[model samples]
Target: MLIRLLYASRAAEAVTHELIESILSESRSRNPALGITGILCYGADIYMQVLEGSREAVNKLYNEITCDARHRDVTVLHYEEICERRFAGWTMGQVNLAKINPSLLLKYSERPVLDPYAVSGLASVALLEELIATASIVCRP
Candidate 1:
């Protein structure tokens, strides 16, 4: 069965644009081969990612991510069998929160920030869906 796993993690340190680009490049190159499609949102030194794929692939990837040195305090926000992929078109969609509209952020949180750790998994997913609807530009690789 297919599954969608959402997780949040803090960057080990300040992440540079170059680093983010490299991460996206690697994901773009690798995810398709594993049947993975997802959206990765980065802001305020935190990452909120939604990965959709076969259960095994998603679980394996989540394990690898938790062990990666770049991430710390990794926390799974959501995981469940899904009938369809929310990010099917993109191998690895990306959003830099700094570029998103504050109004969009305000819809999800009181402080207009990307703090997935403080939000429910359903809310996190809804926030991502809103981002896709309002700012498709940010979802491109």
Candidate 2:
């Protein structure tokens, strides 16, 4: 089954444009073979990534992502079986949350790497969706 997982975490430090590109490049190269596609949003000191793919593929990627030292306070906001690919066109789309909305963090989450919704709390799928929609509109215009 196709899996969709939305999660957020805190970046160790502010991310540079080069760093963002490098991360996205690595992510696309690593997951293209597994048929995964997703968007990554970074705001303030946080990183929010929504990944979708086969069960095994998604699980494998999540395992590696959780272990990566670049981020902390990893929280899975949403996870479920999906009938279709949400990001079927992109191998690994990346968005600088700052560029889309410098206040994206305020629209979705908190800081300190240990926010109140880190676990068993409100999930902000709306915020993620808004980011996606706004980014698309801006890019298309």
* Overall lDDT per candidate, in order of appearance: 0.89, 0.69
Best by TM-score: 1
Query: Please, what are the lDDT tens digits per residue for candidate 2 over residues 1-141?
Result: 899888877777777777777788788787778888887766567777778999898888888888888878787878889999767767777665555543554545554222325533244566656656665412110
Worst 10 residues of 2 by lDDT: 112-121
Task: For residues 1-32, write the lDDT of model 1, one tens digit per residue.
Answer: 99999999999988899888878898999999
Off by over 4 Å in 1: 137-141
Q: Candidate 1 overall Cα lDDT vs. reference? A: 0.89
RMSD values for the candidates in order, in angstroms, are 1.3, 4.0
* Cα error of candidate 1 at position 126, Å: 0.6
What is the alpha-carbon lDDT for the whole of candidate 2? Answer: 0.69
